[model samples]
Target chain A: MNAILSDYFLPCLWASLASAGFGLIFNIHGRGLTICAFGAGLGWLVYLLALDAWGQDIFAAFLAAIVCGFYSEIMARLRRCPVTGYLLVALLPLVPGAGVYYAMQYCVQGENERFLTTLLHTFGMAAALSVGAMLVTSVLRALLPKFHRAIH
Target chain B: MNDDKLLALGAELGRRLMSSGAEIYRVEESVIRLLRAYGAEPQVFAVPSCLFISLSAPDEPAVMRMCRIPAHGTDIELLEQCNCLCRELCRNPIPVEEAFEQVTHLEDRCRKHNPAVVLFGYWMTTAFFALFFGGTLPDCLSAGLCGLAVGLCALFGTRITGSNIFFRTTVHAALVSAFAFLLLRAGVAQNLEAVTIGSLMVLVPGVALTNAMREIMAGDIFSGLNRTAEVILVATAIALGTALPLILGQYI
Candidate 1:
């Protein structure tokens, strides 16, 4: 239990808090900021779980981004705000920042082979994240009004 | 109210949404909805840097308003406020004068986060990011310190009049990576890559990239391409800036 807490739960909590901090930088306020943080945390948790299960980093990113996008859409509908507010901060944790850094480092050192590999991987992961979010958002956009009518 | 005043109000609302980092489609939709509520037919074209809105009521000529939006930082609170205001306008159409007054008040009432809070936010972002990237305790501490420096740079970078973004980004990235390099050299951090990456995460253009993808998928090809260029430019600036110090340190 302690190990699980330290390994998974704590990291997820930290991810949430970190996302909240990011929201603060963009001047998010009130309960909205908290929801954004929670969405990030949930997405990170899903990413970690998928990574462990599938051992594919790109797939993990895609799955996590889908979760984040769905969360953002639901929250936007509930709160009546633009989806960008929640989606932007919630997707922060999954961004391939380290990959970009390493790719550039390899390029600068003239390690062409490693640089190409890392750069390709970084772009692949970014594309996966974007595609995941896009799919979910577009689906929601198409179906939401129908869902609303059914509910009413 | 006159069509001119209604047109101006719609344009102003669109401008505010764009400046606050609302997506292009959202801004365009809101303007159209607001103008329609006011019994006017509306047409809107919005990109990241500018917005144009034209409104016409029956028996009156269309009046167009175009504004060059100044580059501004994202403020989600203000975006939410504006979104709420537009929804209210659409559901319960208000007089043009009252709508204009509310928009002006919202513009004035937009709040900026306190400097100290922003600095703390930066620190938390890096420290947690270090942990998320599998950094140890010392690595997280070092990244947090570097984050404070990056935060200070960002706070002051905005104050300098006419500072080019590329130059500011490059300088800030170099400074943070150099600081991380020093920490590694002094044996204060176990992993230089983790520390540097964690600190660099704050500067990544994640939001821009996400928005770009969404725009393209939504078939706003021109705006999407423009945003994609912005994301690549920013990413390249950050990467180059981070690499410079590491390369120099290797020779030294």
Candidate 2:
């Protein structure tokens, strides 16, 4: 556990700080960074948790969608550029491009079940990330009126 | 003063931009305009930043950006004059990041990247492949990763190359596709995860999303489209490049 924590823990923290710093340097400010960092860290941590609990690659594509939701809403208020940047970067880890590719590979190889699973996961992750981003943006907008002007 | 230092400083400024929650587009344009004033267009690969205006030559054929006094703090009017200089620069045809003191404007933004953010992407791709097609790929059919890696490399290459974005995206995907295929023939399975992540990292519509939201809020679809289309194309190239080898395997 120490080894695992050592390996994952520091990096996750750095990811938070670095991504936070990136947000700050980019002109993101106030509770906006706080919110963005929380979401970014949550995404990183949730993935770590999923990795540990399930081992390797189980339900990650789907859960990553959840993180994207959180990331988009929080970043939308703070960064204020548009939905694409945060939505894309936030969903970076979850994009199922390879999943779709492998599904095709499996289809060619005659594995129907495997192909379907891969296909479902890819679409599921994509849908989830996009919708999640939209949904989160709406929620953050509605709930957090304070960050409105900050929205670029 | 060194070009490398300015570049590094530019990167750090990018990190600060990220941290500040500033519109990376606004910051990048501001920086680009300022650098162009001094006659240097920075070639920094700021995806988060590039999500706004593209890293392309302006239609005006002149550079644009503002600059303030170095040692003395700048007043708002000085900024206006700097903006004036940037307007003129944008009107002239000068190389972007090399026309002036590149780092002086936005030297506060760069920071380290999370390797996990990098690794997770590649790992996600690799695992997705294995989960579905592990049996088909011999004991170690790592070549799929090479294909993905080249896809990403192409995206990064597009940014710095002085070509039009569509051309840059296509060239990047094509070059990386060829590289991935060659690596496979050589039996060298370089971390397909890293390559795919790095290259794809370049094309992700980060700027589009940012600009899309900003434009819509400001009620400017025309400006947003200018940003969005490039992002979508880059993504298309990535998807096509990554899938090419997998698709071709059927015919071969």
**Which candidate ranks first by DockQ, i.e. highest?**
1
Candidate that scores best on lDDT: 1
What is the C-alpha lDDT profile of model 1 across B74-106, one tens digit per residue? Answer: 889889889888888888897899999998888
- Name model 2 segments beyond 4 Å from true: A6-41, A48-88, A100-120, A146-152, B1-167, B181-198, B204-235, B243-252
- Candidate 2 TM-score to native: 0.43
lDDT of model 2, residue B185: 54
- Candidate 2 lDDT, B60-143, residue by residue in tens: 343222222111111212222233334444566344344344324433222322444343333333323332222123212343
Worst 10 residues of 1 chain A by lDDT: A143-152
Model 2, A1-152: lDDT tens digits are 99866556654553454344334323333554555455555666777777778865446544755566766655554443344334434444444555544664577678899978887775555545445455555566677767652332
| True lDDT of residue B123, candidate 1 | 94
Regions more than 4 Å wrong, model 1: A146-152, B57-59, B161-163
